[model samples]
Target: MAEHNTSEERADDMQTQQAIAVEGLTKIYGTGESRVAALAGVSFAIDAGEWVAIVGPSGSGKSTLLNLLGLLDRPTAGRYALAGRDVAGLRGAELARTRGELIGFVFQSFNLLPRETARTNVELPLVYAGVPGAERRRRALEALDRVGLADRAGHRPPQLSGGQQQRVAIARALVGRPTMLLADEPTGNLDSATGADILDLFAELNAGGVTLVVVTHDSTVAARAGRVIEIRDGRSYERDTVRATPAQVAAPRQLQGVLS
Candidate 1:
């Protein structure tokens, strides 16, 4: 009984410190013979302010776990808590609201509106939250400035370089002031040089206390994170938990050629 109480207390403490926590998370598609388990009994906890990378080859369940972490999908059976709130059962408007309020996502494709300016793109989440227009613009500009894109706020997606468009996407993600940033293959669309720059930006943001969780198959990207969660065969394990130093982040292997 004492041990049980202690375990429960520890879990409560973890909930206080963790940005994300999942236990026995499972996802399945179809039924009976056609059933495929994308994730099977995966569990992990990420503390607030930690930078983590989720890595796996194609069909390794990394993307499936990311989708769950981002609240884009629900698990078939498991417990998930986001910032201490039990989110496993939320649906419809409540789920959407929880997702928008607690998490921000950056995608490989730099999903920005081609017709909107950078400032407008960044202001989108605020618009969804029904923030006043003046405040939305102000917050959007602030977020753009954080990503070092303030000068290009008036530029549309087509006018920006691939790297710049991604930076704008990052700014949009940050504008929501989410508990954590969830990035799926954030550097996949950029050249090595530009990707290195974006990685540096991620390092900078992590240094400034923004919690980040990046999903990628790139070993170089994973090495830059403080922890690496490697998913395989529908399960995940901590592959490494060595916090990367600034020097290490600055000179990742992909940047070697550029630096040389």
Candidate 2:
């Protein structure tokens, strides 16, 4: 992958390194009179290494879109491709493997196993991916180091501070080195100061060429991303890109590629 690209170069070549592409994406629940169109023919594309936020009020289909993007649910009628592969038809072991290897997710709630050490929690994805124990340990430690949490690897979630717990969650996400990172309200539980630091980490990761797609209602959170997509009534609308940190700019808090 290109280490850096001018905005023009990036835009011009987005199609070549597409991370996600959806066309006429729709999701329906129930049937007949009870049927609801949770997502209505929404369509969009996100390029590799780009950071995009999905924002909308509650019940506006933001969650629906996020679920589809994260591969937690399938669209009822549409084409969805992730990491340059068509994922709309994958099922059983194939679908499970693709989801495990192609995406890393961070939820608003730090979902670490309270009884497990940070290292073990970070190793979970690798386990599901069928990695060898020794390799998983190496990668898990490497991932914790990336998130600045290597020192806390022996601590369980309950023993860490809230911010530390979140860091551990981030480490877990990075352990797989997936094609994209999907965050849902990643900073929702932290104070503004701590949240900013987390955002900075995300910026560094993006600078290091990780693609990020965040779901948040906070404008400040959305502003941190290079682009934003708003969902309403099951439809999607793209907003012009804005920034807390420019998508391709060197990370302000750290040297570029620090997380690579």
Candidate 3:
């Protein structure tokens, strides 16, 4: 496995070291008196298939960064390259098309249609991509099998438990086989055990070489990632990569006041 990874890294280096590259990225809202800077010269690179976690307190530029990376918002200044192609300037139909083809997103809220079954919900992305009905079912079923949800494919959101619903959302994200999976607080709505199960699924996907960038405030969630990055006040606190196992990063945050 180590040798295989080395070969893959060599191949990646032969092309480019970055899967997603951002340089001097900035985002500003409004103008003059009402203007606010969401991102100020933010820059980062995520290598192909790297599991990176973005952690920060509320109002911290976590969501802002995710939006830019996910192609949901355009940057005010600077450059962003996705898979070696310049995407910062893409607009209108071209931008939307590129995003649809290159990115998959998972959210804290399952975001599944409550009225639809899991299989149907998972098929929606392929449907938008214009895949034929037969092919869409094939891919969606494959994705559900990968996430261990094939047995529950017919269950509606209301009929399934929280964890099962999140798994369905993951199946939908995977059905597209996108270049990157961008998740925003994916386990925020679940109880601890269920959230851990979701994190375990992420770990499995990362092991299979899916590029993952997760934005989360939960320390336990952050611990599951291969690399953890902290953002504070719209700026990075520690840019250096630190090597730590899940056990290391999971140390309980020290409490300052009386216990409950």
Candidate 4:
């Protein structure tokens, strides 16, 4: 009994520090005859520094869950606690501020500004957050360095290769040192080799204690994460049955070998 009570106490403490928590989360579109439920009573918690992957086929609630987690959309009926603060009801400027302060986003499309230098692109978030110019520049350069794009910081998006541009996007996402990194199909556009490299970068970031939540349809990508949450028909389930191919499991080992 004592051990069970201790375990329960530990779980409560862990939840208190959770980077993202959702309970009974639901999103519905339209109404009556045209109603569509994107997410139906989803519940989960992602702890700080853990690597999680959300995987599903087309029409699943993967994107819908990502939107809610990123604070881009509100749930119809649920509780969402980001970094221990309930934010399910926050809207407008409050929502934007919370998102900017606690969450960093990386999209499959390298959404870099076409005419801006990589450094300038990375500085945009800091600019919005009201960081001073000199400080923003310093942080942007540091973020670029973290993603191994410091040498290309002066180059515009069109001048960089696809992989390089994605790295710049990642740098931009990390510039503010957000509490959680939310990536949606991050490697969807890259070639196999380049995607592998990006996955390695993600592993490195996770190793350094970044809380990462990746939304992808690729089983290989999901295999690399520490935990996999499979969403189907607007509901989430923790995947315990192995869905990874032998090659998929071996890929991360190969990456680890290279890193070593």
Candidate of highest TM-score: 4
Candidate 4 has a TM-score of: 0.81
C-alpha-based local distance difference test score of model 4: 0.81
**lDDT by residue (tens digit), candidate 3, 72-162:** 8888986777876678568888887887787888866778999998999999988888999999988888988877788988889999987
1-260 in candidate 4: lDDT tens per residue? 33666876765666555777677788998999999999888877778898999987888888788888888787888767787777756888888898898888987677789999999999999998999999999999999987778899999999998878888888888888887899988887677776787788789888887899999877788889999988878877778753442111211221222212
Worst 10 residues of 4 by lDDT: 245-254
lDDT of 2 by residue, 16-75 (tens): 577887767899999999999998887677888999999877887876787788888888
Clashing residue pairs found in predicted model 1 = none
Clash number by candidate, in order: 0, 0, 0, 0
CA shift of 145, model 3, Å = 4.0
Q: With candidate 1 superimposed using the best TM-score fit, by how many Å does residue 106's alpha carbon deviate from the native?
A: 0.9
Give TM per candidate.
Answer: 0.79, 0.79, 0.78, 0.81
Per-candidate RMSD, Å: 10.5, 8.3, 9.8, 8.9
**Considering only N, C-alpha and C atoms within 3 Å, which residue pairs clash in candidate 4?**
none
The count of residue-pair clashes in candidate 2 stands at 0
